[model samples]
Target: MTIRVVVADDQALVRTGFRMIIDARDDLEVVGEAADGEQAIRLVRRTSPDVVLMDVRMPVVDGIEATRRIVADGAAARVLVLTTWDIDEHVLGALRAGASGFLLKDIRPTELVDAIRGTARGELPLAPSVTRRMLDRLLRTAPRMSAPDGLESLSQRETEVLTLVGQALSNAEIARELALSEATVKNHVSAVLRKLGLRDRVQAVVAAYDCGLVRPRRP
Candidate 1:
């Protein structure tokens, strides 16, 4: 299936550049483009794209509010925040506003394409750099909420799986660590997310760090 995408950026050049790369892909299509956040929201509502590439800064509305509106309205389209802002506040704001993941604008074309696909597949495409920034923010700030009530329902094994997920390990890596098949690891990951009412692994990671289920590494 072709994943439909909408590119929203204040810069015409940025939007055009992304459209070129995305339209070149066999499995991806640029269904629409927006010059600002309000337009982004309107395009999303009209086109219902599978994914949205959002820039944080814009003249009207701004990406954060646009993302908030999209997710709050229960749109199926996932938002992948692609902005030049690599700061912790922007990353946290986007995630809290229900972005599927965050990536810097400087990401390679191949990585950008993969991230959109991953977001469409209900996976978080958080970059390592973004993750590091997020972790720093998490360590310094209190969680937005105690956690979803479903967190208390997780089994011990499921909790362990969530902890590994917090570390950003793939299912195969978690499987090897626990001496389980990759399939089993995937199951655990799913259960963990379901039990916690998380939208994706990115939220799971934040929750784990939030509730102190996983501690920050001593670097």
Candidate 2:
């Protein structure tokens, strides 16, 4: 199946570049282009793309708000946020706003394509560097509070899986850590998301930090 996508960036060149790359793939199509967040949202509603390539620094509505609105409106299109900076508040904001993945602008073309596909597949495609930075930021900034509603519903194994996920372990790594098959780990991760009402693993990581399930490392 061809994955429809909307390229949203304030810079015309960036949008064009992304469009060309995405359109070059047989399984990917650029259905729309937007120069700002509001336009991105409108395009998403009209085209119902499988994924949106959102720039966090766009003018007008801005990508984070656009992502929040899209998710709130129950749009099926998953958001893949692109930004220049790796560790920053905007990245966290995008995550909280329901982005399915985050990638730096310097990411290779092939990696960006893979990220879009992964997001469409309901996987959290965060860059490893971004993931580590995001977790560190969360530890410093996110409030240490009670678990979000529905966390207690998780089985013991599910809770274990969530902890591992929060630590930025991939499904295969989680499987290795727990001595289970990768498929089993994926199932547990899915269950954890469902039980926690999380949009994706990004949110799961936030929840892990919020609830103290994963502790910050000592200096």
Candidate 3:
């Protein structure tokens, strides 16, 4: 199935560039474009695209608010936030607002395309260089000092799986680290998310950090 997308950025050039690359892919299609967050929401509602390439700094409304509204309304479209700054606090806001993942604006075309596909598939696509710092900041600044009620339900093995996931390790990688079958790791991951009341792995990552289940790597 073609992955339908909407590119919402204030710059015409950025939108055009994304549209060009996306349309070149046989499995991807650019269904619409919007110049700002408000337009993005309208376009999303109108097209019901599988994914949205959302820019965080748009006028009229910021991407974080737009994402919050979209998720709150229970729309099927998933948001993939794109920004020039990888470590911007807005990235955290966007994630908390229900973005599937985030990408640096300078990401390679192929990576961007892959991120779009991954987001559509309900996978998180964090920028490699920013994950550690982002998670660290999330740990420090996330509002709650204690674990959420559902978080305590995770088993010890499940907690370990969640920590690796917060580290942004893929299922195969997690399996390799834990000496478990990939299927078992997948089941653990599913249980972790289900028990934590998270929407996807991205939220799980945030929760893992927020609850101090994962720690930052030393420099």
Candidate 4:
């Protein structure tokens, strides 16, 4: 199936560039484009694309709010946030708002295409250096200290899956490491989120760290 994408950025050139790059690939196509978050949502609702490449600093509305509404509505479209700064707080907000992942504005065309593909599969993108610092600071600033009631209900296996998510493992990679099928890993991850009352994997990652289910690597 072709991966339909919606490109939403204030700059017409950026959106056009992304559309050309994505549409050039056999697996991807730009179904629609928008200049701001509000328009992006409307386009997403209209097209129901598989993914959205959203800029964090758009006018009228920001990407974080748009992402939050999209996920909250349980739309099928995934969000891939774009930012100019490394470890920008808005990046965290976007993720917490249900973005599947993020990309640097200067990311190579191939990498950008790959990020869209990965996010459609519910996987995180390639921002390990920036992401690591973001996750660490998030772990410290997060207010999940009291622990949600549903979080305590996770089983041992479910807990493990959440920890791996916190460590940034994709479902396929998690399956390989745990000697399980990708479907099974996905199941566990889903159950973990349901039990934790989380919005998506990004929140799952934060929950794992906040609950001390995983530790960050020392820099």
Per-model C-alpha lDDT, please? 0.82, 0.84, 0.84, 0.81
- Comparing 3 with 4 on TM-score, the higher-scoring candidate is 3
Candidate 2 deviant stretches above 4 angstroms: 126-130, 137-146, 216-219
How many pairs collide in each candidate, listed in order? Answer: 0, 0, 0, 0
Q: What is the C-alpha RMSD of each candidate to the true structure, in Å?
A: 2.3, 2.1, 2.3, 2.8
- TM-score for candidate 3, residues paired by index: 0.89
What would the TM-scores of all predictions be?
0.89, 0.90, 0.89, 0.85
Off by more than 4 A, model 3: 126-130, 133-146
| lDDT (Cα, 0-100) at 38 in candidate 4 | 95
lDDT of 3 by residue, 49-150 (tens): 999999999999999999999888788898888889766778888988888888888888998898888888877665534655555654455464456568
Better of 2 and 4 by lDDT: 2
After superposition, candidate 1 runs with Cα above 4 Å error: 126-145
lDDT of 3 at 58: 94
Number of the top TM-score candidate: 2
Q: Please list all clashing residue pairs in model 1, or write none if there are none.
A: none
Residue 167, candidate 3: Cα error in Å is: 1.7
**Tens-digit lDDT track of model 1 for 1-219:** 999999999999999999999999999999999999999999999999999999988878889999999998788898888767555466677777788788788889999998998889877575544664556554555444466678779998998898888877777778999999999988898898787867788777777877677776654
